[model samples]
Target: MPQKKLMLLGGLRYLLPVIEEAHKLGVYVITADYLPDNIAHKYSDEYCNVSIIDKDAVLRAARELKIDGILSHAVDPGVTAAAYVAEKMGLPFQCSYEAACILQDKSLFRKFLSEHGFNCPKAKGYTNVEDALEDVGFFNWPVIVKPVDSAGSKGVTKVTDKADLKSAIETALSASITKNCIIEDFLDKVGAQSSADIFTVDGKLVYPAYSDQLFDKNAANPYTPAIEIWPASMEQKFQDDLTAQLQRLFTLLGVKSGIYNVESRVCSDGKAYIMEVSPRGGGNRIAELQDMATGQSLIVGEIKKALGMPMDDITAPQYDGVWCNFILHSSEEGSLVSIEIDPEFKSKYVRDVGLIVKPGDHITPFKGANNSLGTLFLRFETREELDAAISNPDSWVHIKLK
Candidate 1:
C-alpha cells in the first residue's frame, strides 16, 4: 500500500511534533512554505518552497505532491489556504473555506458573533486611518486596535485616549496582510483571561481545556501572552457556559473534528465573551502543555484526523496539577549573554527548559510570539505557588543581554 501523504502549511517549530506524529503513523510529511531554512522542513520527508498564504500556489503544490491531507497546525496565516486546498481535494478539514475566512479575520468574527447574539464587543473594521478616525465616537473608551488578519498579537494596542487612535490604526494596518484593522471596545476581564486549545468531534465539543493567559506589562507588547497556566481561574459556571457556546458556534459553522485555539474572558459587566476562535492549534505549545497536564495527546489525535483516519478517544481532561508554560523572552534588545534561572526554582519547580538562542546570538524585546527565545515548562503543587512564581519571574528567570 502507498503511504499517505500529509502536507503541512507552515514551517514553524510547532510543526515539529506534527511531523513526528505523521512519521510515527507511517505517513509522508511535506513541509510547505517559502522559507527553505525553517526548522520543521529539516525533519520533514520533503520540502515544498511555496508561499503558504497563496492558496492557488499551495493547491498547485498539493496536486503535484498527490497529498492525501493538509493542515495549517499552529500557523494562522495559512489556515484559509489549507482549507481551500482541502476542500478542492476532498480532504478532511475542521470547517469549510468560507468558515475559515470568517474565523481567521478578527473583523468578520466580531460581526458573526454580534449577528448570532453572542456577547460581542462593539467593533468596526477599516482599511484606512482617515475613515477610522472619522468614526472614533462609534466605540467606547479604552478600545483595542488590532490587525484584522494577523495573530500572536503582532499589532495589538490598547488606546484609552482619542489621540492615540490614528497611530494605533496605522500600526494595526501595517501588521495586517490585507491592509485592514479593527477597533473594538476592550473587555476589562473579571480575572485572568482564558486562552487555550479545545477539541471538537462532529461539531460537538469533546475536550474543553482552559488556561489563565498571562502577560508581562514590562514587555514591549503587553497583549502577547507571556505565561499560560492550565486550569484557568475562571469560575466553573462560566467555563461551562463558554463550552456550550463554543459548541453552538461550531455547529452553526459546520465544524468537524479538530483542535481550535480559543480566547475568551468573563468581563466586569458579568458577561462571558468569546474573544477569538481560530481553527488551528495555538502557538506557545498550548496543546503540548495540555498533554503534560493530562495524559491525553491532542497532537496525535489531530494528526490522525487530518489523514482521514479514526481519531483516538478524546474526552474532558483531568489535570493532574497546576502547570505553566512560560514564554522565554527579553525585556531589552541586545546580544544575548546567558539565561539564568534561580537554582532553587530550577530544582523545585522547573521541569524543562528549551532555549533557541545561545550566547552571542542577538535577541529582541518581546513583541509577539515570534520574538520569544524559547519556552520553560514548570509544574506547581498549588495555584498559589504558580501565581507567586510567575508574578515575580524577574527574581528567578533572567535574560542577561549585552
Candidate 2:
C-alpha cells in the first residue's frame, strides 16, 4: 500500500512541526494556502495554492490529492476548512461541520452557551455599528467588543465607556470577514485567566489542562496572551468546577477526538465561566508547552486522530515542574538589532529559546500572535519563581532594536 498522506491547511510556521511529525512517521505532507511564500510550504512534500478560508475550494483540492487525512493545527482559518474537507471526504474528524460553525463564530458560540446554562457573558452580535450602538444603554459598562470570527485578538477591545462604543464596534466589524461583531458584558476575573489546551477522544474528555493566562496591560493589544504558566494558580475547587463545565460543553457541542484550545476564568462572583473553546491547536506553541509540561505530544495525538490511528498517548497530563512560556514581542516598530535575555535568569532557569527574527529584520508592533518575535521556555523549580518572573518580565528580558 502507498504511504498515508496528510493535508495541512495554512502554511504558517506552526505547521512546520506537524510536517516534521508526519515525515518522521513516513507520511507525505501537503501544505496549502493562498500565499506561495509561507514558510511551512518549504518543508512540506508538496504545496497547493488553495485558499484555506474557502471551504469548498479546499475540499476540492483535497479530493484531487486523495489525502488520507486533513488537519489544520495552529491556524484559525484552517480549523473550519479542515473540518469541512474532512466531513465531505469521509475522513476522520474531531468535530462536526455544524459544531465548527458554532465554535468559529463568536455570536453562535455565546448564544449556545447562554442557552445551555453554561456560565457565559451576555453577548449579542450585529452586522452594523449602528445596530450594536442602539442597545448600548442596555448593557453594563466595561464591555468587550470583538469580531465574530477572527482570532489572535486581532480586533478585541475592552470598552469601559459609552463614548468609545462606536469606534470599538467599527474596529471589530473591520476585522470580521462577515462584517459582524459581538459586544458582551465584560467579566471581572478573580485571578489570572485560565486558558490552556484540553483533549478528547471518541467524544469523551481524556484530560483538561489548565494554565495561568498572563497579559501585559501596557501592550498595544492587551487581550492577547503574553505569558502562560502550566498547572494554573486557580484553586482546586474552581479548576474542578471549570473541568465539569468543559466536559458538559464538549458533549453538548459534539467535540470528538483531538486537542482543543479552551479559555475560562473564575469570575469575581465566584462562578467559573467558559469563555471560549476552539477545536484547533492554539497558536504560540501551546501544544509544545503541553508536551513539555505533560509528557504527551498533542501534535502527535492530533495527527493520529486525524489519520484514524489509535490515540494511545492520550493520557492524564502530569506536570514535572512549574513550566512557563513567554511570548516575546515589541510595542515599537523598527528593525531588530539584538535580543538580550538578562543574565540573572538565564543561567539555570531558561530551558530553550526560539528567535523568529534575526538582526536587521523589520518588526511591527506587537498586536497579535503574528507579531511575536519568538518564544522562551522556562522550567521553574518553584511556583514563586515562575510567578515573579512573569509579573515583571521587563526587568529580566528586553528586545533591543535600532
Candidate 3:
C-alpha cells in the first residue's frame, strides 16, 4: 500500500504533536502556511508555502502535492479552508464547508443556535461600523463586542456604556479577517466558563470533556484564558444537559467524525449556553491536556480520521485526578527574563514545562493566547490543592522581566 499523505494547514507549534502522531502512523506530513520560519514547518516531513486562508491557493497546492488528506488542527483561520478543500477533494473532514463557515463565525453560529432553539445570547453581526453603531440599542448594557471570525479573545471587549461601543467595534473589526464584528449580550456566567475539546464519531458524539477556563483579570485582554482545569466545576447536571444540546446541534449541522473545540457556560439566568464550537483542535494544547488527564489520544484519532483510517473507540473521558494547564504569560512588554517556579511546587505538582521563549527573548504583555510564553502541565491530588495553588499562582509561578 502507498504511504498516506496528510496536508496540515498552519504552522503553529500546536501542530507538532499532530505531526508526531502522523509520523507514528507512518503517514507523510506536509505543513503549509505563508510563514516559512514557523516552528512546525521544521518538524513536518515537508513544508508547502501557501496562505491557508486562501482556500483556492491551498486547493491548488494540495492538488499539485497529490495529498490524500487535509486538516487545520488548532488553527482557527484555516478551518474553513480545510473544509472547503476536503469537500472539493472528497477528503475526510469534521463537517461540510457550509457548516464550518457557520461555526467559525460567531455571528453565524449565534444565529444558528437561536434558530434551532439552543440557548444563546442576543447577538448581531455587522460588516460595517455604521451598521453596528446603529444597532447598539439591540443589545443590553454590558454586552460583548468581538470579531465574528477571530479567536483567543484577540479583539473581545465588554461595553458597559454606549459611548464605548464604537471603539470596541473598531477593535473587533481590526482583528477580524473578514472585517466583520458581532455585538452580543454578555451572558454573566455563574462560575468559570468551560472550554475544551469534544470528539464525535460518524456524526455521533462519543466523547465529551469540559474544563474550567480561568483568566487573568489584570492582563491586557482579560478575556483570554490563563488557566484551564479539567473536570470542570460545572455541575454534572448542567454538563449532561449541555452535552445533549451539543449533540442535537451537531445533528442539525450534519457534523461528521472529528475533534471539536467547544466553549460553553452556565449563565446566571439559570440556563446553559453554548458559546462557540469550531471544527478543529483548540489552541493552548487543549487536546494534549485532555490526553494527559484521560489517557486517550484525540491527536491520533484526529489524524486517523483525516486520513480516512479507522479511529480508536473514543468514549467519555475518565479523569484520574485534577489537572490544570497554566498558560505562561508576562504582564508587561520587556526584554529577556526568567520564569521562576517554587521548588516545592515544581517537585510536587508540575508535570511538564513547555516554554516557547527563552531567556533574553523579547516578551510582550499577555494580549492573547498567541502572546503566551509557554504552558505548565500540572496535576493535583485534590481539587482543593488545585484551587489554592491557582488562586495564588504568583506565590509559586513568577515571570521576571528585565
Each prediction's whole-model lDDT (CA)? 0.92, 0.87, 0.94
Among the numbered candidates, top TM-score falls to 3
User: Could you give candidate 3's per-residue lDDT for residues 314-373 as a string of tens digits?
Assistant: 999999799999999988999866898999999999988888998899998999998999
Per-residue lDDT over 81-173 for candidate 1, one digit per residue giving the tens place of the 0 to 100 score = 999999999999899999999999999999999999999999999999999999988988899999999989999999998999989999999
Q: Cα deviation in Å at residue 33, candidate 1?
A: 0.4
- Which residue segments of model 2 deviate by more than 4 Å? none
- Which residue pairs clash within candidate 2? none
- C-alpha TM-scores of all predictions: 0.98, 0.97, 0.99
Residue lDDT tens for model 2, 141-233: 789999998888898899997999999999999999889999999999998897787889878778788889888787789888889898888
Using lDDT, give the best candidate's number. Answer: 3
Instruction: Single out the weakest 10-residue window by summed lDDT for candidate 3.
Output: 133-142
Stretches of model 3 off by over 4 angstroms after superposition: none
